[model samples]
Target: MNSSMDLLQNYIQSFGYDWLSNVLLITTGSFFLWVIWRLIYGRLEALADRTQLAWDDLVIKAVKAPISMLIWVWPATVSVGLVLATHSNDDVVWLGKIDLILVISTFIWISLRLISNVEAHVLDQKKRDETTVQAIAKVARLFFVTIGILTIMQALGLSLSGLLTFGGVGGLIVGLAAKDLLSNFFGGMMIYFDRPFKVGDWIRSPDRSIEGTVERIGWRMTIIRTFDKRPLYVPNSVFSNIVVENPSRMLNRRIYEKIGLRYDDGDKIDAIVDEVKAMLEQHKDIDATQTLMVNFDAFGPSSLNFFVYTFTKTVNWARYHEVKQDVLLKIMAIIKKHGADIAYPTQTLKVDPIAMARDAEQPVGIVER
Candidate 1:
């Protein structure tokens, strides 16, 4: 072994240049490292694919990039270290610092990769809505990134206490400057955790014009696709401050309308009310589980008013509309068939003949001309 080392050293020195040695060493190390990486990665990938646990795939993918990078990095690091061994001054200290920084950077990269994979895996397993899952994953990544950066800074010989002292004051100034932005950011966080509504849910603000299916929930704002196919961007803080109605959560859609029939049809009002109730009860699309009211509710000047109050079995907007139309048509048919007319507003006034004659007998109170 000693003789072989002597032969290689002699061959390298035979080149008459010191840098040639380093170049050769790095080239040979990098070549062999790449070969080893290929073999290891291939084996691991096959094993991952064969396993039933899907997390293994994510784990394998997460490491593949870092490990590939490490292959090149390790060889380069070793070669640099060998070269630096020839120097014994401040250069050594500088090289050591660079090496430490590289190590810290590599760790941060690997940690971030793993965090991303774990976040994705957990969200997929939970089957969370797309927008909410994205928000959650971003928050998770941001948190890990913050911690990782701090760790790297500490590894670079930064004093954590000093940084904290400085950052506290700077952070306060930044917070005040970005007050509304921070409110929106926290509002997004609250929405992610509270889950008032999610992607694909139809939501509306009672006080605002924002009404639509949720398309995206980001850190600052949420994108809602409106009924007319317009996209509405609403600030996250708005949601925190307002009352939102999620009609998608409703079990049934309501139908409430008043029908008026002529006063001449008053005799048929009872029969009409009974028949309407029977019709509602027999309708398949009407929700029997909810309230149903069909009664003569009021007397108008020209008509007897009856209200049809019921809930459809479906929550679909178009389906509810169709059901309502069918119900109204049936009611009209019942009214016509029963010799009762649905009335429109009309006014009539008649003065008595005796009152007119008495008024004529008495002198009209009018201005003399």
Candidate 2:
């Protein structure tokens, strides 16, 4: 027993014993973490397969379970064991500082990954709904990066208040330099809250007179896909200030036009109006509740002008055009059936035949003919 004790004491005194113990601890911790990772990943995969929710699958795909698990668990386990292995007081202090850094970094990494997972899962639900999720994802990423930076600085023994003061001064300068940018950023927030238009909505602005589908509402700008298949990036500030018309939100739209008839055809004006009102009532695309008016608006020099107004039940541009074309064709046929003609600008020239005859009769007198 004395010999065994002596041998144990000798081993403890040697540097090799301490190194070996640390190695064993590290290996054990690593193996334990690996096992935990495999178990958790396996369970997550199984749950994803069995669940009816597609978002779960998205979460798994986004987080990449194995990588996420390692990011969280590896540092924690290693730091714990390293803290336990320290002997001297100075060594313990150094190990504590190292552990602090490891813990903060690990937490930051995990937080960032979790945010990514949430974004990916939400976006995978639908294409149009992804716009809001994408914007939120950008904001979340920025927030996490800021947190990570602050945590790192704190770990390095820097005063947070001093850093905050510097950041405040810097922010003031940046704010002044980017006033328009700040305006756009706030505009984006207002747009989100106000919800004047959503992604995939077709909108028109009176000032710019641009018509397009909303593609994305971003921090500083809103992207639109124009009718001509071009992308338009309008500043959020401008979007907020403009008078926007969201045609797609309407249930129906009004169509009005004017046609001219010759003054000689005035007798048929009432009949024509009756025919038009009847035609509009019979059409499937025309709204019945709307006031369909056909009136003699004014009289022109060569023609009589009449106004026609009706409501289309469809708000779609293509469908509106189709309905309008059909109505026009029907109107033309009705006019022809009634033996009435459309008129254009015309004028009459008057000539004095008696004066011309007198001039012709006296023209040869000077020659004694």
Candidate 3:
């Protein structure tokens, strides 16, 4: 052992300390790193299996322990090996540079894994009611990527001040080029914070109207799947600018309808109004707190028109329709019971061609030749 050590020392000395120290250091560091990695990874895998938490499972899935080990161990081994073998000479400068790169890369990888874990955790929490979680996740990812890029630049020996100066100029140019993109990005943030609507909400805008369930909130747009199974992509900018009507948020939906009666049936208007109000009051879905008004709204050319205005407690289309149908059926029954009749527009006219020709031939009370 003593002779082996002496021979190793002599060989290392003759070969120039830089090369020999690097080799020895790298080999030793790699061996130890492998042992530690195997032990830690095995234990973590076991722990992950025993835990019932889904976020832990996500962590295991997001990060490949073997790949992480390789990335972390290799550069550290080479850096230490070169420093020990060459006594920190210029020949190992390349190894230092590689080491810096590796460190930056590892940090990025770990940060990504951490972000994934955070997203998983946030999704797991049921109390986070906003559907904008996906938008939030995207913003977080961008932030982490920016940090990673800055770290890599620093590792490359680039001064942060100069890099930041260039980045500011580049950002201005890029922002100008992607004005719509910036609008969308800020719009997404507004959507998340302002929370105009949420997933599963039915919304309508002035220009665009659709009854859909919000599918997902993305970084630039919000996706909605209509009842007909068509996907709608609405830009966040438009959402911020447009008037959004969220039907789902309404406590009740107002319904206004008109029914016409024969002009001769004007005497029955008061009775019809009373019957309609009774029918509305008996409706299961009608809001009792709302004023059910039946008023004589118009005198048409051939009919006496009355209007019924009420609110339905439920916003569901089918349920509202069902309630309206029941009310109409009740109204019809009441009208028939009272022997009253609805009216349709009609007209009568007379023509006298002979009399019109005689009148044209001579003025009234004047003699004609």
TM-score of each: 0.79, 0.74, 0.72
Whole-model lDDT for model 3 versus the true structure? Answer: 0.75
TM-score top scorer? 1
Tens-place lDDT per residue, model 3, 70-121, is 5456545444544454454444344555556666676667667767777768
Clash-forming residue pairs, model 2: none
Candidate 1 vs 2: which has more lDDT: 1
Backbone clashes in candidate 1 total 0
Q: Could you tell which candidate, 1 or 3, scores higher by lDDT?
A: 1
Model 1: lDDT equals: 0.82
| Poorest stretch of ten by lDDT in candidate 3 | 1-10
Ranking under lDDT, best-scoring first?
Answer: 1, 2, 3
Displacement of the residue 295 alpha carbon in candidate 3, Å: 2.0
lDDT of each: 0.82, 0.76, 0.75
Stretches off by above 4 angstroms in model 3 are 1-62, 65-92, 117-126, 208-213, 224-228, 348-369
Cα distance off (Å), candidate 2, residue 228: 2.7
Q: Give a tens-digit lDDT track for model 1, residues 95-145.
A: 445555566666667767877887778666877566666776786678877
Query: Which lDDT tens digits does candidate 2 get at residues 1-369?
Result: 224323433444354546456556556766777777678878998989998987666556645644655555544544444445454333333444555666666566666777787776666667545556776777888888888888878877899999889989999999999999999999998888778888889999888968899998888999999999999999999977789988879977888989888888899988997998889998999998888888888998888888889999998889899999999889888878888988989998888999888888885646555
Assess candidate 3 and give its TM-score to the true structure: 0.72
Question: Looking at model 2, which ten-residue stretch has the lowest summed lDDT?
Answer: 1-10
